[model samples]
Target: MKNLIILSIAGFLLGGCTTGTSITKEGTTNDPKWHKVETILNKDQGTFPNLQSLSEVRQGMTKDQLYSLIGRPHYDDGWRPREWNYLFHFTTPGQGENDITTCQFKVIFDHNMIASSFYWNPINPKNGVCPPNIQHKQIANKRYTLSVDALFTFDKYDIENLNTKGKEDLDSLVRELGKFKELNTIQIVGYTDRLGTQDYNEKLSYNRAQTIKQYLTLKGIPSQIINTIAKGSEDAVKECQGISEKKQLIDCLAPNRRVIVDVDGYIEGTPENNPAIK
Candidate 1:
């Protein structure tokens, strides 16, 4: 179904045809067709409703199975592997249909069989929040996903927990970033262990993130260039054991007590203004 859609659009564009009706996986519809077609397609996931799970969307399937499972591709971009994209609206403008949203998926084929696949519901994703605007980067003559992580601590934590040695190390990092002129955006991720209740943990995480931003500002890093986030105890350490009955939960979740800072932007060459941080 997806491949069909892509083919439909490409043919329409190349031929400069303005057919009163546009053909889509959900069948055919007239101008102002997107909403109606999307509604019909999502009626029950038009292409491959039964093969719902990622596990079920296997890497290899006989042509018969592919047809029965996912209808004919509406669009196939043929990117290295093949790409089939389907568009559907889970929501309509009427009442707040939060449950009714839109989504997309891509299936890549190697030798006409699935090689890799991805499903996305961009309303919200797990990899933290994303900025409003982003432009992808091209690295090594090929496209790549760029990501970074930043670590921040308050003066008190640096003094008591991290000790002077850690503070000195952080100072070096600050200098390195201060001298950095290649990046455009910086993301500061903050974390707080479960030492306290959830509410306190959230506040603590926010404060820690702010502390880093403040430090960066003092170093003349500029506030507008940085974005901050707090993860709290969500990503707790997985390698550690449970804290003793007498111990605190925060201690047990200490592994999650860290932040990730990412800086993105153009380096020396290339097209410029490419988003770096993922």
Candidate 2:
């Protein structure tokens, strides 16, 4: 009778082990049958990856490269696992502003630790595939130029130093950004006139760019999608070589002392049909 009890106990242990979650034969870790929603770190708040970056994801990319593009998986799959899962949110075309489509993306890695296969689930029959609105759409790349004199006082690069006109300009920019439901990237490039030392100019330009980024973030732009670059005294649009007067030189280099913001995002429909372009 004791031997019979031991056999029953062994069967129970084996059954418990089988109930634990694991990757399926198809290499999917987030099977709805066994996967729990609470296991996902992001949960309801999925990532909104740039459309261009999503398009760039191709087969055979390394794990690091994939991480840089879309970010780490939403859930922990295990150590050195072959599958990575992500939850992404996209804005639906012709829908209300609050309406968004959530999709599950899966990436399968080969033995060599390289991404090989990609899959998207919860496909919409009307939309055709998982990632909707990406195909047949064009990214509207717009550039806005803001003069340094209008934005800040001489030799100032802080939000507190932003002039009244600067605030209005940035506010207008925020409104322009609101037109698009999906934003890819916002690049802020800072430039300075050739007056100070090279190191000082570089530092000043960087600080200016950083200030702009901070202002935009405060106005509701995501910090992750904004990038800042400093180009001090480089690519000057106007060169005043013969002007020796300090005021004249500075005035001549006015065009160089400016910040350029490049915004990239997708609009509904093709380039020809996009109303924003027209």
Candidate 3:
């Protein structure tokens, strides 16, 4: 009995040591499951439950039920413990754009460990019932942040002539904004690259934020619900140095120019006292 216990302890410690091995393209590690997962993610291709199977998933299903219905989940403990996540990717080498979608299903269990309430993303499932009044999952505070290059022209910040890519990005954001009902304040903070003088940058950043507020207000968000701030050249996410060329440097510091719209308040439909509110 003593020798058997010692062998089990040694085996557990050995398993812990293998978890840190760096994933590689060539399957050289002793862990095959970890290697397979890494390969799928790295290459952006993998198998997941089909939409037909996913449609059968319900709000009150147990973890065991979920496993039975969809085989094993793609084991990820990074997010909430009770949340079951799945990523479905369909691709044909010569077919249309790959349809990659993410689905997150979270179950809140009662004292008896049975599922009580639930929520999920991809809200309107093609064949399944919507998870009984889905609510915006909170993370301390809700923030809708985006870089300036992702919303406006290279150096300009006008809503009328927003670039094609920017328009698509904003459309997605607007859809999410429509989901929330308890928006106390929506702050729009603008930043700029460190190319111009501090005074010039400050004014430019402020103008960008104001324009954003106007755009949002035009889209039905109340003007009073919005706040604007100008970060100017401060807090640059990227400091592009060495290259002294005028135009080249500006392109490199694109990430520094950004505008973040933060929505401060609780979302509608979610339980106020839910322990998973973090």
Candidate 4:
């Protein structure tokens, strides 16, 4: 409402609030939120769903203990056999009517550690983000690992601050995965900062992921090695039917649009017991 914003708070934390221009003008910058997500996603890697949570999911967790810690997710949204979705709602700040904060979590399990993960907040929609310092990995079985997000920057999105650090972090992450020899198939899913139509968002997410693929290929990664897709607004971080803030329609949608990385590979023959717990 205050200004035009491109938000991606589906993360567990928030990116720093920095000034950025748009693709339109030099001064009309592109908010670095994309960069912020780039850094975070590139490092840990994977699409929205990470694991099948027990019915009672808690703040601190591990897969082995998911059954006891929490029960199972209320719903499991899986597009395919190996992939699934877990939607979670949580809060951070503010009070009274808007006091409660809500979050949606998407996790994928491969034959190894987490295949990918996406965290969202539909209430505020575009206000949560993660910090670069956080470390993530699978806990139990590699495929069905109990992954955890040591997230920071809870209330705001500081993607602009993610910077080159994000790029290098992700580059290193991919290279590390390459070391696993068993690593083979790869999928790149892209989401956008809230703006545009569902159709446009779908294409934009695809293009953005394709652009990432190009960069990865140039870095010794191969095109034949990866598969890519875009869901546009269908896979949005926040699903909104009505305007929460009419004045800031763009801002409202910022966190809803986003990009993700999904992978299908194997490790240790047994394959990670990647299952959709919810």
Top candidate, metric lDDT: 2
Candidate 3 C-alpha lDDT tens digits along 1-278: 99999998876654432323332332122322222234223233334333224444554567688667666545343322333333343211222233223333444444343444444434223333222222343312467777788778776877775777777766777777777643445788999999889998998899889887887787767675578999999998889879899888988998889888877543433333432211
Cα lDDT tens digits, model 4, 156-267, are 1133332354456556646655654333345666555445676776676676556556666767664655667776656555555587675466555656444455554323
Taken over the whole model, the C-alpha lDDT of each candidate is 0.43, 0.74, 0.57, 0.38
Which ranges of candidate 3 are over 4 A from the true structure? Answer: 1-140, 269-278
- At residue 158, candidate 4 shows an lDDT of 32
Sort the predicted structures by TM-score, highest score first. 2, 3, 1, 4
Error of 4 at 190 (Å): 1.7
- Candidate 1 lDDT tens digits, 189-243: 7666555688876776777667666766876665755677777667665535555
TM-score each candidate: 0.39, 0.57, 0.46, 0.35
Arrange candidates by lDDT, descending.
Answer: 2, 3, 1, 4
Which has the higher lDDT value, candidate number 1 or candidate number 3?
A: 3
Q: Quantify how close model 1 is to the true structure by its C-alpha RMSD in Å.
A: 14.9
Cα RMSD (Å) between model 2 and the true structure? 8.7
In model 3, the clashing pairs are: 148-258
